[model samples]
Target: MSLEVLQVSKQYGTQLAVDQVSFSARPGQVLGFLGPNGAGKSTTMKVAAGYILPDAGDVLIDGISILTHPIEASRQIGYLPEHNPLYMEMYVVEFLLFVAGLYQLHGAEARQRVAGVIHDCGLEKEQHKRIGALSKGYRQRVGLAKALVHDPKVIILDEPTTGLDPNQLVEIRALIRKVSQYKTVILSTHIMQEVEAVCDEVVIIHEGKLVAQDSLKALKQNTTEVVFVLETQEEMQSKWFDDLLGLAKCHLISPTTIRLEAKEVFLLRTELMQVLNSHGLTLISLRQEERSLEHVFYELTAPRYNV
Candidate 1:
C-alpha cells in the first residue's frame, strides 16, 4: 500500500466531520473515495494531505505518518482539493513553477516536472494563459498538473472532474489510469459513472463514518436486485404495468418511462417486452441495469426514512 488512512477523525467544534475512518490505497490501481456530499470525503482527504491536523489517528504516505512526520509525509503526497485554488494573476506555467519552488525543487528538476505535468495533463495548449483567464475545465487540468508536478508516490484528488466536458472527462480518466500504473491514487467523487469508469477498488463513508471498503466487484456482487428500465416513444400508461407478475415493484418514472425491479433475473425482461408488443407500443429502448456502484452507494448512504 502506498497510502494508508488509519482510523482518522476530524471534528469542527461540536460537529464531527470524520469519525475514525480507515482505509488503504494500493499502487497500480485507482481507489475511489466515494460518498455523498458532506460525508467527510474532503476533510479526510485534507487530513491525509497534511492540510489539517486530525483530531484522532494518522495517515501514512509511503509509510511516513502525516501526524508524526508532517513535512516528510507531505513531501510524498500531492492533493488537488475539491476547490482548485490557484493564483489567478499568474500564468499557468508560472503558477506551476511557483509550486515547484515551494517544494524546494530548483533549476533543471523544476523545469522537468513542470514540463512533465503540462504534457501529461493535456495542458500544453493552455500553458501560456493566465490562470484567471482560463476556462473551468482547463483550470481543473492545471490543478491536476500541479498535483502531479511533484511526482509524489501518493495522489489524492477530490472531485477532480467537476468542471470537465465529456471529451475532457475521457482524457483525464485516461491520464489517471496512466499515472496510477506507478503511483497510488485516491479519487473522491459522488458521480457513480466516474467511479465506475476509473476506480479499481472503493472506500465509502456515510455521515462521517466508514461504511464500505472493498474491491469494486465485491461491492457489486453483494446485492441481488435486478433493475430494468423501459423507455418508449409514446407515453406509457401505469395501468399497462399494473398487473405484471414477476416484478417485485414497478415505478413509473414518467409518461414515457418506467423502472422495473425484481429479486430474480431472466424472464422479467421477456415479459416486459411481450407486454409492450401486445399493447402495440413501439419500443424506443430497453436496457437491463447492472448492479452499479450507484445502486450500491444508495443502499449504503441513503438517509433513514423512519426517522
Candidate 2:
C-alpha cells in the first residue's frame, strides 16, 4: 500500500472528529474520499499528510509511519489542502521554485522539476504571471503544480474542484487522472460526477465513522434495491405489480407509469415483460433506472437505521 490509515482517531475537546477511521490506497489508484460536512474528511487527510497528530493510531506512507517519522513520511506525500494558501505576490515559477527549494532542490534540478510540473499541470501559459493575477482555475493549477513539484509517491487533495466551472472541472479532473497514473491519490469532494469520472475506489465517512468503502463498480452492484421505471398504455393498479416475481416493492407514479423495486433488475425485467404480455397490456416503454453516486452516498450517509 502506498498509503494506509490504521485505526486513526482524532478528538477536539468533547467531540470526536474522527473515530478509528481506517483505509488504504495502492500505487496508481485514485481513491475518492467522500462525506458530508464535518464528517472528519479534512481531519483524516491532515493526519495522513502528517500535518497534525492523531490522538490515537497512525498513518503510513509506503510502510513508513507518519507519527513516528513525520519528516520522512511527509517527503513521500504531496498534499493540497482544502483552502489552498499561496503567496499571492509570487510568480507561478517563483512559487514552484520556492517549493522545490524546501525539498533542498537547487540549480538545474530545481529548474527542471519546476518546468516539468508547469508543463504537466498546464501552467505553461500562466507560468510567468503573478499568483495574485491568476483566475481561480489557474490558481488551482498552480496549487496542484506545487503539490507535484517534488515527484511525491502519494498525493492528497481536499475539495480540489470546489468552485471550478464546468470547463475547469473537466481540466482539473483530467489532470488528476494523469497524476494518478504513477502515484496514489486520495481526494475528498462532494461532486458525485467527479467520483464517477475519475475514482476507481470510494471511501465514505459519516459522522466521523467509516460507513462504506469499495470499488465504484462493487458499490453500485451491491446496492440492495434496484429501481426500474415502466410506462404502459393502460392504467395499472398498485396490486397489478404486487405479485410479480423478484419484485420487492412497487409504486404507481402515474395512471400509466409505475416504478418497481427489486433485488435484481434483470430478473425483474423479464418477469415484468411476461406479466405484461399475459395481461395483454401494451408496453409503451420499460427501462432500468440508472443509479447515481449521489443516491449511493445518501443511502450510506442518511441518518436512518436502514441503509
Candidate 3:
C-alpha cells in the first residue's frame, strides 16, 4: 500500500469528527474520497498529510508512520487543500520556488522541478504573472503546481476543482489522470462525475463513518437495483407485470410502456421474454437502466425513511 489510514479517529470537544475510519490506496491508483459537509473528510485528510494528529490510530505513507515520523511521511505526500491558499502578491514561479524551498530543494534541482510542474500543470502561460492577477482556473493550476513541485509519491487533493468552470473541470481532471499514472491519488470531491471520470475506486464517508468503499464497477454491481424498461406494441395494464416472477415492483410509464423492478435481473430477463412470447405481445424494446454515481451516493448517504 502506498497510503494506509489505520483506524483513524478524531474528536473536537464532545463531538466525534472521525470514528475509526480506515482505508488504503496503492500507487498509480486514484481513490475518490466522498462525504457531505462536516463529515470529517478534511480532518482525515489533515491527519493523512501530517498536518494534524489523530486522537487515535495512525497514517502511513510508503510504510513510514505519519504520527511517529511526520517529516519523513510528509516527504512522500503532496497535498492540495480545499482552500488552495496562495500568496496573492507573489509571482507564480516565485510561489512555486518557495514551495520547493520548503522541501529543501535548491539550486538547479529546485529550478528544474519548478519548471517541470509549471509545464505539467498547464501553468506555462501564466507562470510569469502575479498570482493575484490570474484567473480562478489558472490560480487553481498554480495550487496544483505547488503541490506537485516536490515530486511526492502520494497526492491528496481536497475539492481541487470546486469552483472551476466546465472547461476548467475537464482540464484539471485530465491533469489529475495524468499524474495518477505514477502516484497514489486521494481526491476529495462532492461531484459524482469527477469520481466517475478519474477514480479507480471510491471511499464514501457518511456521518464520519465509512459507508462504502470499492471499485466503481464493484460498487455499482453491489448497490444497483436492477430496473428494466419494457416497451410493447399494445397497451397493457400495470397489474399485468405485478405477477411476474422475481419482480420487485412494476411502473406504468405509458399506455404501451412499463418499467419493471426485479430482484434478480438476469433471471427476470429470460422470464420476461417467455411471458411476452406466451402472450403474443409484440416487444418494441427492452433494456436495463444504468444507475448513475449520483444515485449511488444518495443511496449511501441519504437518511433512511421508515415505512
Residue 222 accuracy (lDDT) in model 1:
38
Ranking, lDDT, top scorer first: 2, 3, 1
Residue 116 of model 2, lDDT score? 100
RMSD of 2: 5.6
- Tens-digit lDDT track of model 1 for 1-307: 4888998989998999999999999889999998888899999999988999999999887788888889888988889999999999999999999999999998999999999999998889889999999888788889988998888888899998986899888878888888899999999987888888899999999999999999998898833467878888887776677666566666566677776777667536466667888888888887888777887787678653210
For residues 1-307, what per-residue lDDT tens digits would candidate 3 score against the true structure?
A: 3999999999999999999999999988899999988889999999888889999999989889998888888998999999989999999999999999999999999999999999999888899999999989899899888889999999999999988999999999999999999999999999998999999999999888999889988887733368787898987676666667778766666677776767786645577877777778898988887767775676677654221
User: Ten-residue segment with the worst summed lDDT in candidate 1?
Assistant: 298-307
Residue 245 of model 2: what lDDT? 65
Task: Candidate 3: give the clashing pairs.
Answer: none
lDDT of 2 by residue, 209-281 (tens): 9999999998877344677778999877767677776777666667787767787656554777777877678
lDDT at residue 16 of model 2 (Cα atoms): 99
Candidate 1 vs. true structure, TM-score:
0.81
After superposition on all C-alphas, the RMSD of every candidate to the true structure, in Å, is: 5.3, 5.6, 6.2
Q: Which ten residues in a row have the lowest lDDT in candidate 3?
A: 298-307
